[model samples]
Every structure is written in structure tokens, then in C-alpha cells.
Target: MALRTYDEYIESLKAMRPNIYKFDELIEDVTTHPATRNTVVGHGHSFKLSSEPEYKDIFTTTSHLTDEPISRYLSVIQNREDMWANSRLKRRMFQLSGTCTGGRCVGWTSLNSMYATTYDIDQELGTDYHQRLRAWLKDAQRRDITIAGALTDPKGDRTKTPSQQDDPDMNLRIIERRKDGIVVRGAKVMICGVAAANEIFILPGSAYREADKDYALSFVIPRDIENLTIVETRHPSDKREHEEGFDIPVSEGGITQAYLFFEDVFIPNERVFMAGEYKFTKQAVFNFISAYRAAIGGCVAGQGDIKIGAAMLVARANGLHTKVFKDKIIQMQINNETTFGIGIAAAALGKEHPSGTWLCDMTLANVNKVHVATLPYETSRLAQDIAGGIGETGCMPSWKDFQSSRYGHLIEKYLKASSSAESRTRAARLVEWLTIGAGVPGCMHGGGSPDGAKLMIRAFGDLESKVEIARRLAGISEEIPEPGGR
Candidate 1:
């Protein structure tokens, strides 16, 4: 089977039912709709890249299931090598797209995480979920579809669990289990990249108690499946998506989030990987973050790469040499590599799961997650610091205004720096867009919150042994405790 080209991909999305909406208006064609088109176009770049000889390896891989040349987006991370490839692919995607290409990144991780989880489920519960997943994956590879992974649930109150909530639908739940399939109801909010996807991969939002079994659900369904309504979430860049200006550096690239309401959606048994398996919910979530958090280092680093380039361009636009901000640029480079190196370390140090999937080192991956949450902002700050006020602030005239008859010439003439008016303004706009616009990704909480990663750090780390090692090195054999504890 052949992989999808960029045009074929767009046509496929166009053929889907109109279930996605933005600004209370139905998006008939995602490829042309202002709200969704940019993201779709951004993701489509990978389709073109997959055909190129140099990038073919980065974007295309043989599916282990069928041994067919498929999109790397469809490849499973079977070993440390595959995991490293996945990380590099993510960084390259961000480098080219200049934004989050969640259509494949998260969904790829979701499938891989489920690969391990379903194996455990089948071993203990004697279910055929692993087989079901294999069948679905085989078909998915054949189609070369774009999948957006959905994991976050809008829990109404923090203190209450899913079962304790007055609204049981606070977390997505299985409303009923028919012989042929299951019925699901509830919303997955703030899900990234649904606007650019052909399908949605659903995973349990979090660990759940047996009493909350209804909420312990996972499945895959067409994005436009009946009873599914997608509403693109709001962002500071919403207006900029439609703006006629240098505000959006790349008109074909942007990022999106959505609220997916599954109003009693029916997913066939073959597509259901986990249903009412509350005991394995924690395992499923663990499997997910292990990969998601680690690779996110690449995501931020890619954007940081762009930030550095834009900042330098702005400096030259102002007639300043690169040496003027050498220290700042060096600091930005350090920030990018820190998170990136930590992620690669996690991948290299990982152990293979029983399911033949490579799981990242929990301690190092969480450590990267913490860096992902904090370092990108400092990088952004340095880029802005180097770009000057015009590049950092969205205060310049719009592209339309810059072309207006009345004051266009005056505006253009004053906007000129050491570079031409157009070049100077364009560089400024790019820096602004990257640092503060849609180019900014969910660094602090893309996969999960940093606090959650810290908790995992505590769980996976050997702190007691570290303390013992410290005691021996200090030549203090007796137990020396903290102020209040032994």
C-alpha cells in the first residue's frame, strides 16, 4: 500500500463529515478553513517530506506489523533505537513545522504506550485486547492516517474522584457495554491536534479506582464519528490565524486544541483496547508519560532552534552583528540541549518491556519533563531580549496597514532599520510570533503537569539508597535523620 501524499491527505480530511467547529461556525473544509487550515497545512508538510530521499528515513519507516513502508507516524517504538528515532523525528517535525504537529506525535506515543499496557492486560485478564490492537494498527498503517491522541478529562473539582463527583461524566466513561461494542459519553478537553487528524486515539485520563471503572476506557474512532462534536479551543492567536499581516510567519503552520464531546459514541469491539479495566489504568497512564514526557524534550528544543534563528535575524535587521549577543545566544543553545540531552539519555537508558516496546527511564524522563516545564521559557526570554522592543512586542502595523494607501509609505519608511523595511519588519514579526504567538507550545503541561512528573520522579527514584551512599561517604554509620524524622 502507498503512503498518503499531501494532496491525498487534504482530500481525505475534506471527505470526512463536518463534526468540527470553531467560533460557533461549522468548519466544512479543514484545509481551507481559517481556524484549522494552518495546522492542517503544517502537518501536511511531513507528507511531502516523506517522499524526499534525505528525509525519507526520518518520516517514513517500515511497519513492524506488515513490513510495509509506512509513515513513521505509524511506526511503533519497539526498541531503544526506534525510541531514539521517534525522538529525532519529533525534533525534526518541530524544526520544519515551527509548531506542534500533534496529529502524529501524541497519537504515536498513545499507540506505543497501549502496546505495553494491552500486553499486561491480556496476560493477567486473559483478554484479547493485544490482538485487537494489532489488527487495528495493521489497518491504520495501511491507511497512513493522522491520529490525534486524547487523554485529558475536564474534572470539575480537584478534591473529588470520578466516582465521587456529582457528575459521573467528569471523566469520559463507558456508558454501556453491548455485545458488539461499548458506548462512551463525556468530553476530552484541551486535546491537541484534532483539527489535523483523520482519527482520534482515546486513553484513560488518569488512574482510577474500581468504583470508577466506567471511567477507565480507551479506544480509537474516526474523528467525525457520530455523536462526536469537536470545538476548537480558544487561544491568544485565534485572531492572528485569520489576520492579513506578517503576524503569522508561516501561513501554512500553526497549532490547535479542542474539546471532544463524545455524546454516547459507539466504538466497535475491535477498536476498543481498554474497557472497564480499572486495575490497569495506572499502568496505562504510566506507559504513556514514560514516552511522552521524554520526547517532549525534542519538541521544545526544536522550537528553541527557531527562536535562536529568529533572534539573530532580528539583530542583523537592526544592523547589529551576531557577536553583540553571543553570550545570550550561547545560553539559549545550552537551554535547548539540556532538555534534549536528557531525553536522549532517557531513551538510551530505557529497558524493553515484555510487550517488546521500549519504555524510557522513568527517573531521567521525569527529570527531562521538569526541564521541559521550565527551560523553554528562559530560552524564549533570551530570544525576546535579543530581538528588541519591536520584535518582542506586537506593536507594529499590520500587513494590511503597511499596504494601505493613506499612510502605507510613511509606515514602511519609518519601519526600516539597517535592513530593508520589509526585511526588518518581517524579522520582527517572526520573533514576536515565535515567542508569544501560536508558535509557543504547551511546554509546561503538554503531556501532563510538571508536578505530576515530580511525583513520578519520587516513585521511580532510589532516594533511600542515595541517602545510604551519602552516609557511608561521610563516615557516619549511625542513622542521622532530618530535624524531625529518622
Candidate 2:
């Protein structure tokens, strides 16, 4: 079947009844809830783009599994074109939401990584995980299902492995192995986009030793799984949503981050793609996250574009468009475009995995994430700076107040710069949304934390080769002895 249209996708979400909680109460309907409905609209934008004639090529693709058209989020990268297409689709998704598009990018990256990593594991251990996963992907593509990626562990202690955790529940584990499937217990913290997803894929977050066998569990759980409960994350701005309701200053498009609780949730045997395969866990996590980090460079750069534009608009309205202010605008643009360039460069340098999927260059991918970790934060800082003190002082004025004679003249007299009072207010609102609302944290840690990016740099640094080059250049290289012919 071809991919579902935007309307059809929304209908599917409306049909599912998820057991989700936010703020101390159960969310009755995801489509109407203030905190989650906006995110659903953000996801709808992705489906809308896929159907639009201008975006069809980038957002939709012919599935390798079914040969039918599917969302690019469901397409596996098998060639250079596919790699570029994946990067483009993710950027569009991020721009639509102005935040994370949930778990689409992570799941997309994991598809290729799991295929390649499992192939190597199967070759060494006679396992058939690669085949099982391919079968599942075919089903997912045909059905157009949204799969949430569960990669981060609760990580109860900084210095301990999963096996050494004080509480086993701190690590997701296989509590029972039945003839039908494996039953898992434990929870995943900071899982992205749980409110909007139809299913979840749990993958190991760290390398597993033989002693951590039960910790090496991987499978898919339907959002409606009997024992699963989702507690949506509370952001600092969430209170504003509660106070102001739907018109929460920020855009109607945002993402929902949540913690997932799996209380003895069961996965059918067909869905249990990885079980007690400790050796493959590390490769699975690394391969997936590295590719995802490269994709983040594109998504974060797109969000930066929106933030930078908002700041510039506020600057112009405040009559702060002097050379110094314009120069700051130029700096914002440079920060954004630099991050975007790394994404394209990594895609250009991609190599084929053993399974034939294109793998982005690891070094360039890590470099892209490092920039993502720092540049957006710096850009947001400059944006808040240029926005002046009004961002902090501006009071919420109703449309009635703007139109009334009591305060209309006063607002027009004080708020106007290059435009009317309404325009300046809108600009200020946009700036507030990016600089202090839902956008900044995603910029800082969406791909990974800045420190996580630095860790990758140290882990992947090839300093030994640099040392050898330095020795040779300094005329201190030792000659290697050659074996004499017999």
C-alpha cells in the first residue's frame, strides 16, 4: 500500500487510546490535550509535507521492502541518494515542529545500523536477527507505523554497569522468557516523543558483559501494551501552557518528551529481535547514535534558522538594526549555516556498510554533533541579547486591549518601531519562544549533550597517526628492518 495521507494519519492517532499521564492527571485524548495536541500537529506537518507536490520527492520514497511509496522516515538508506534524502527529510521535520520530531531520526538511523550490526553478529554467532528485523521493517513500511526509539537507560549510578545497578529496575531487563516471547521489566528515562508514537523499540544503551545478559533486550512494544504507562516530561515552560492554555506564546508546533515505564510488558517471539546477545549491544548503540548525531546537525541548523529570523525581526521592530545589530544577525547566520554544512559534508563522505546501507563518515558525523552542541546555544544567547530587555518586560496584552482606545494609543506610541504595535508584539513572542521556551534545551542536548560530543571526539581521535607524522617530519623516524629473501 502507498503511504497514508495527512488526514488518514491523524485519524489513526485519534483511533488509538493510550494510557498517558501529564501533570497528575490522565490525558483523555491526545488530539485535544494542550500539552500533547500541539506535538500531534507538528507530526501532522510531516505528513502534510510528504503529500505536497513540492516536497514529495524529499519526504516520500519508494520503499526497498515493498516497492510502494512510503514516508522517508520509513525508508532505509541503501545508496547516496537515499542518504541525502534522509538528511533533507529530517531537516524539514525539525523545522515543522521547531523542536524534536520525536524519534523519527533515531529510528531511521537505527534501521541501517541494526541491519549492518546484526549481520556481523549473525556471521559470528549464527543468529538470525538481521533477517528478523528486515521482516519487521517491511511490515512497518507497509503499515506506515511510527516507531519510538528507546536507547537511553535510566543509568541509576554514574560509576556502575547495568549488572551492578542498585536496583535492577534502573536497567530495562528481560524478566521472563516464555515460549511465546520475552517479558521485560524496567523503564527508559528521557525517551523522546512517546505521546505521539504507535510503538516503541528498546535497544541497549551501553556495552554488555556476559554477566549483563538479561540487560541485553531489544523488542517493539505497542503503545497500548497492557502494563505500559507513559509519564510525560515536565518542562519549565509547561506551567505557562497550563496558565495561558492553548495560546502559550510559543508556536502550536512542539515536541513531547517523556519517560516510559514497562511493568512486565510482553513482546511476542516475532518481535523479540535481540535477546541476551550482549556482544552485539555495544555496536548497536554506537552505530545508531553516530549516524543520528550527523542527522542532528541538519535538524538543529533548521531550528536555528527559525530562531535567528525571530531575533532579526525583533531587532528591526525595536529599531536596533544598526551596523552592530546587523553584524550580530550575520553571526547567527554563520552559526546556522556552519552546522548545516557539516550534515551535508558527512552525507557526501558516507561509505557503504557491509549490509549495503550507506554509513556516514564517523569523524565528520561527530564533528557535526559537536558544533550542534555549541553553536545553537551561542546563537540563542546572541538572539536574547539583541532582543533587548523588552522580552523580559513585555506584558501579555489581549487583542481587546490592542483595539481599545484606553490602551491602544499608548501601546502604539511605545511599541512601534518599523511596524504597528501588533507586529512588534508578535516578533517579541517569537523571540521569547526560541530563546527561553521549548527550543533551547533541544539545541543543547537533542543529539546529545556537549560533553557527550566531546567524549566522542576523544574516543575517535586518531592521535597515534599524528604522532607518527610528526616524528617523520622532524627526521626522527626509525627505519623498519625488511626480511631477507631465502
Candidate 3:
């Protein structure tokens, strides 16, 4: 059934048939499981927001192929306005979901990359990859499916390539080819929403060499495919939540990343977007980054809004909302706005690619990601600072204490916020949930590491032109015959 509401999406996950493993055992119900439920809730919020009238323009779009209304996540940006709209939509979705929306951006990025790179591949290799991709995307929209993108391969050793890994299955690769389809093996790690996703859109993590051609595989498969298994990573707080219920300091956060195993799984040719297209991998990566990096600015900033608000509320509860705390709040606002500002700048400065869709300004897009890698860390640091010692020491008192007639009055008396323990506890829980709970570290690393942002800055920054500018300023222009050289 096409998902029109958050309820529909949740119901869809409840009905999914998949070989999903959490720890060592099979998970019968991912939709209701503690480990997967929060992530699914986050995903549901994303879908729910799109239907809100105020956000409809940003979150929903007319598909270029079918002209039917589809989630912005499924649509390719056909114009500059579409680019800006998507950035804004992503921010709202992330804000509604708190921090991580369980890799929805990854899926969106995959779609953008496939659209751009497929067109280029068809142009260069006379392949129909672009046509096939569009057809698949159209179907995905018609079905209103949720896709989890599998991009990060488990690099068994940082020193080696996929084919050179000690265990070839450490990195996902194509195993065999049949006339109708291909079989694949190996695994994709740190895959978000694998259990909740209807389909897994698989792609190589990096460019490949001729010897590594078999490792250069890309395709789409149902999450419930027979031979595919998802072993979900356990969140640091998962055990506590199951044992203690909402009494755990932080009850809601991004759940876990799952490692998806493809054990000789067959993917029909129609589902294969790119296979052994080594050169196109780089193009695909860049195309995805061009749009996705810009998107990070929006979502992270939105998350910052939540963090900042929580921090201020906590500080107020703890009687620490001083002028200094106010200033920190201002700083948080600046960081949040600046991050979002870059996303808008990237989108506003977008250019249409030769493939007929718009491409965000690469320089601004990289700048957006660079800010995303840093600003949220600063925001979290300040949040922790305001939270203070009570944030660490506070806990939910037993419900029995409140339920007892004799202790009930005393519990209420002691639990009040100003004089109210409940208020203080709630504040602390909010701080704990966001800072160390599940949001901060993931925000820093989810899109990419800090070093990745620096690398992008170096690549996009034109040092050669700066050097030429310096030479001209020093009266050393070649037109003037510098140092008597012709």
C-alpha cells in the first residue's frame, strides 16, 4: 500500500518480512522492537510533516516523470527552486525527528547520484542506465516506498581495497552473473534503517580499479530478499532502555546502524543501476555529495535548534540561566542559523547540470558540510556546559514513591521544578538524551568525518588562482616578462 500517513508507514514496517538479526537472534517484530522503534518513529515524523499544509510545498513535489505527487525525497530537483525547497524540507524533517531521521538523507542522496551519474554513464558508454534508473524511480514513487541506501562498505583493513580484503565478504561485491540477473555477496556496514526500509539501494563506497571490477556493484533489492540478512548494531543505551523502560535517562534517540549481508542474493537486471562502472563511481559519489552535503547544513542546524532550546530549559530549571548562559544561547542560535544559511546559499546558487536537473553550487555545498561537521559539536559542548553536575546526577525517582499515599505528598513536594524535582529531572534527561545519549557523536560523523570536510575544502578551494593573485600583486606577471624570462 502507498504510504500517505505516518500511521501507514508504521503499519507497513509491521507487516515487512525480513531476516533481521539484532544481537545473535532473529528479530520477529522490528516495528515494535525497542531497538528499531525509535528510529521508525523518527522516520514516521518525516513522512507526517510532508502532509502538513504549511510544509507541503517544501516536502511534497510533482514527480518529473509521472507528474504525480510524491515525497520530496523521491523527486529529482528539476529547477533551482526545487533545490532550495528540498533543503528547507530536510531541515524541518530532521528537527521534527530530533537529530537523526534514520538515513533518509542517504536514500535521497542515492537518488540524486543515480540520476546524474546514470545520465553521464549513458552519454559516455551508450548504456541505458539513465533510462532504467528513471523507470525504477518512477515505480518507487508510484509505490511510495522507503529506501535505505547502503554506501559504506566494511573496509576490513584501511590499507586494502575491497578485492584485497582478508575476507572478500568484508566488502560487498558482485559474485556471479546469470542471463537474467546477477548474484552478490559481502556486506554493507553502518546501514541506517535497513530493517525499516522497504528497499536497500546498494552502491560501492569508493571508486574501483579494473582488478576490483567485481567490487563495483550497484543495485536495488527488497529488504526481505531471502538471502539478505541485517544484523543491527546495538546502541549504547539500548540495554538500559529495555531493562528500565522510560526511566532510563534518555529514552528516545537514533537506534542503531545495521550491517547488511548479501549472501548470493540475486538482483534482476532491471534493478541494476550500475555494475562494474568503475569511472562512474567517482561521478556518483560527487553527484551525491553535491546535493547531500548542502542538505546536512539544514538538518543539523534544525537539530541545533532543539538542542539549544533544551539547554536553555535545563539551565532555567537548574537556576543557571545567567547572562553567560544567555550569551551561549545566542552563540547556539548563530551557529544554527549560519549552518542553515549555507544550505540556502548552496541551493540559491544552484546550477542545472547537463543532465537536465539542477546541481547545487559545489563550493557552497562543501562549505555547508564543513560547517555541519563542526557547529553541532560546539552546540553540544555548550549544552553540556549549561546542564552542569545535576544533569549527570539526576534520575527518575521510582513511580512507587509517587504512588504511595504517605510518600506521594512528599514525593510531589520534592519533585517540583523550581522547588520541583520533576522539572529538574526532565531538564537533565533532555540534556543527557541529546548530548551523550544518541545525537552528538552521530551528527559529527553521520554525513562524513571532519577530515572529509577538510578534504572537500582543499579540493574546492582554488589555491592556484590565489597563487596567481599573489604573483600579480608582487608585479611578477608573465605579461610583464618577470625576472627577464620570456
Winner by lDDT: 1
For candidate 3, lDDT tens digit of each residue in 1-486? 233687777777777785888768888887777777777766766677777788778778888887788887778887778877776876776666665665566787787778888898889999888888888998988878788887748778978987788788777788898888788888777877676677888777877888788877778788888898889887756644243423443333364688887789999988988888888887777777777788778777877887887777777776654576788889989998888888888878888888777787778888888788888888888888887754542355544555568787786676565536666666666676677766664556665666776777787787667878888899885643346652
Clashes of each: 0, 0, 6
How high is each candidate's TM-score? 0.97, 0.92, 0.91
Candidate 2 Cα outliers beyond 4 Å, as residue runs = 241-250, 320-324, 392-409, 478-486
lDDT of candidate 3? 0.75
Residue 82 local lDDT, model 1 = 80
Best by TM-score: 1
Model 1 segments more than 4 A misplaced: 241-249, 480-486
Cα lDDT, all candidates: 0.88, 0.76, 0.75
The collision pairs in model 2 are none
lDDT of 2 by residue, 1-486 (tens): 568776777777777766889987889878788768877777777677777899999988887777889888877787767876766777777676777776565666666777777788788999878888888889888878776788757879968988888898789999999988898888888877767777787788778999998998777767778998889888656655343322453545777788888889889887776889998888887777667877787777778788777777777887766466877778888988887778778778888877877777767778888888888888888877887765542454655566678877886687777877777777776666766776766666665576777777777777567767887888986843335721
Provide the lowest-lDDT 10-residue window in model 2: 241-250
